[model samples]
Target chain A: MTGRVIVITSGKGGVGKTTTSANIGTALAKAGYKVVLIDTDLGLRNLDLLLGLENRIVYTIVDVIEERCKLKQALVKDKKNPNLSLLAAAQTRDKTAVNAEQLKSICDTLKEENDFVLVDCPAGIEQGFQNAVAGASEAIVVTTPEMSAIRDADRIIGLLEAKEEITSYKLLLNRVRPSLIKSNEMMSVDDVVEILSCPLVGIIPEDTGIITSTNKGEPIVNDEAALAGKAYRNVAQRILGEEVPFLDLDEPKGFMAKIKNAFAKLKAKV
Target chain B: MEKGFVENGFIIDLSDAKNTTQLVFELSSVMEHPEVKRKNVCLKLGALDLKQSQLLSIKALIESMDANLAFIDTDSEQTEASAVSLGIIVSEISDNLEPSIVCSAAEEVKDEEVVIKTECEVVEEDKTVEVHADLNSNANPIETAEGIEDIYDEQSTQELSEIIPAEHFEANFEALAESEGLIKAEEASKYILLDTGDVLPEGAEENDTNTETLPTLYINQTLRSGQTVSYEGNILIIGDAHPGSEIVAGGDITVWGILGGIAHAGSLGNVTSKVRALKLNAIQLRIAGLYARRNDTLNVPYVQKTNEFTPEEAQIEDGKIVIYKKLRRD
Candidate 1:
């Protein structure tokens, strides 16, 4: 079956683009789809590290493009999920080594064998970002609620529109703090969506479990107890054309606990 | 060569015409047709290789017969230019040529009607008005200075000489000013006013004196952050100007929606220009040489409260950009 190539990009750095790509790839693989994740960050390759497949990467995307190795030989298979594999970026090479046409040809060949190919894009609207988005038919922009991140996301969306190959795009609001949003201190999901004006793929709340999972080089989606893990699974299901309701971040535990907490606060006020 | 009769014209194809004599013979055959002579039918010349002089002679022959003619299917630019130089209207060289000529002729008729209506009104107001056939021509000499006495009897002249309304005169003056590019239109009022001191209407002098209407650029979508729009003229946005988006205009800026970005209106140092917005939450604003940042302590006038937000306008006051509510004009 032919796979759909999707790129996960955030114009601003440190906004969980790699994490979102890793988790979505893993979640799709867990759902029994053959998925391949390519880290197009070039010198700053980090998708393999996020997937815990860093040790297995003997060859990289540059090796395939430069004819140093076969495309299959460069793919590093994940330890946990046999269906999930990664084509890591070359840590020594720069972004200019691979052009859009080369990556597009590689993605075309990879789509013949895998069900999904997710490219983890590099930050900034530079050569690296162009290389990452060159092969994808769809884009998922990751951004935080901050002004700077939203501004960069806007610019990236404009660039993506200019890239005629990417026909559809969605936004993934990462690291959302529902408490701060409720207190009117931070931008809400609606505010971010209104400004960005893109369809929402998923909203992953600010979870500490994401940090622990990153330390272990394991995507948080593997943990059933993690809220962010569940969110990524929901995103994967949505990508599979399933209508999954968004997770209510304010009541992460249970609806009963949320009501009881509200009563307690009202009692204290009285 | 093929000669055929079509509706309202005859199509004489001179694709095989090898000499100027053959070309003239083909044009003469089409012009001599009874259908073409009975009415002022358009003779469409097709694929002719005639020289400029030959074409001009053929056009003169067609006009001598009182039949309208046009070079309708010419591929040569030289032929088209020759026809235009000879004052012969060249219909578009396309498959459906008749409708294009008809459409342009209809437009000319409409323009002439407007000119006639304006001239008629001017004549009725003042019999001294001299009507020019071509309003766009710069050489509009007065045809006659004979007053209302020449056109009407004494009784009718008295009725027609009743005071012309000021509004109609102003419209006529504006039209004249636009065509003449004169500053006299603004001064025309001072000469017409009785010596009694009455304040001129608020916007009347302003419109006349400001002859150069500033160009305006319109943005109908939200300007997101990181997007900077710099215009050499005034800017009008129908959507929100989000934070981090910068708009620099050389003239006044008007935002129909919320303005939260950095706006520099009148950037070329025109201090009288202002920036108006429905909600002025701008991070920084500059009008001309004056600058203003969003401050919590500055108390400005005319802050109107809406349902949820307060709409504010900013203008240069006392050499600084000050935020105020939009004053109701009425």
Candidate 2:
């Protein structure tokens, strides 16, 4: 069966591009759909570490492009999922080793067997970003509520619109904290969506468990109790043509907050 | 025709060099030898053409090593024209000429042509890297290997086979600033070896060619990310090697500052070559056929510019890569 080729990118660094790719790819595999995560960050690769498959990598994408190994040989199977595999990037090599055409050919070949092929792009709009977006039919623009992130996302969307291959594009708003937004300290989710003027796929709440999961080399989505994990799972379902509502992150917990909420609603009616 | 006589000179034969990179790399590696510091260098460029800019760079590179370009012999018409325009002499040495050494492999030289001989050739041309080294008219380095090893007494290979299999190793690195006693056991387990078997190049024979005998390439600049420095002999860096950078040497690698990249020592299969840095923070350490990586718990991104440096050294011992942490001063 043919697979859907999607590229997850962020124009700025440390905006959760690799983390999103690992979590969504795992969520899809857990749903029984075969997925392949291709890390296009050549010299500064972190996807393999996030998936806890660093020690198992014998060959990388550069080896495949250089004809030192077959494409299948370079694909390292995930530790938990049989259907999910990783085509890791060479940590010792740079972006100049693989050109856009070679990455396109690799994506073309990978989409034939897998149900979803997610490309984890490096930061910046230079050669690395161009190589990552060369063969994708869909794009996931990951951004935070900060002004710098929205500005870069807008620029990326403009570039994606110019490419004929990108049939659709959606925005993934990450690291959202409801308390900060309510206190007027951070940007609201609606402000980000309005600024970018792009359709939203999912909103990932700010969770402390993400840091622990990253250090443990386990994706946050695997933690069933994490709000960010549930949010990422909703995103995977939405990718599969299902309608999943956004999480109401502003809803306050605790007994005193429930009474306060009732009084606030009654006062609004008057 | 008889050529003008010159003293204290060397004829570097680059006739087999396939490209400019190979030519420059081979030339730089040999030129850094202390013996060739003041010697004039004569290059033999084969059929390969050289642009004026490329020739200028090569000339500048040779001058950087405190050597002079005496002349060059080239077969390519384009190279001759380029050398003539750059005011470089393009002429061949006649058979009647007398010098202390001759590297030209011609059918005409029949008499006592060479008083000096090549001290290199242990490095096989695997993935392209083989060149005749700088010649000295006086000393044979092979006989002096033992004496040179004595100079590096603290850095000696002390029972290398026993260092790896041991549960704990006594800290043996004597600090250059102060010689302190043994301290911690956890300091020696910095890198964990990989299980990949027999990673040596095809048809590569294991040998302990004295790394002291090989020439060194001294680099004085900070190596940024994505940059690589590969040499056929020992390499000494005066600055830091940033993450994402790679330094591949055919012999020992020494860095005066932090080494945060991948270092491949003895790339041609000389297991005795060592990798040492002011701060041994390499992401991956490779010695000859063995490979090891930093512990995952200590894999945090390298940052912070601190003045404190605990110099460490890594070498192949007992078929496993072992690290020795220098003692810290109280």
Best by lDDT: 2
Poorest stretch of ten by lDDT in candidate 1 chain B: B184-193
Chain B TM-score for all candidates, comma-separated:
0.33, 0.45
lDDT of 1 by residue, A102-192 (tens): 9989999999999999999999998888888888999999999999999999999999999989999999999999999989999999999
Candidate 1's docking class is incorrect
Model 2, C-alpha of B139: deviation from truth (Å) = 53
lDDT (tens digit, per residue) of candidate 1 on B235-303: 767667875467887666767567766687777656666676767766556666555544422211112
lDDT for each residue of candidate 2 in A1-270, tens digit (9 for 90 to 100): 889999999798898999999999999999999999999999889898788766556679999999877899889898789999999999878899999999999999999999999999999999999999998999999999999988999999999999999999999999999999999999999999998999999999989898888877789999999999999999999999999999999998788998999999999999
Which candidate ranks first by DockQ, i.e. highest? 2
C-alpha local distance difference test of each model? 0.68, 0.77
Residue A231, model 1: Cα distance from true site in angstroms = 0.4
- Estimate TM-scores for all models: 0.44, 0.61
| The candidate that achieves the highest TM-score relative to the unseen native structure | 2
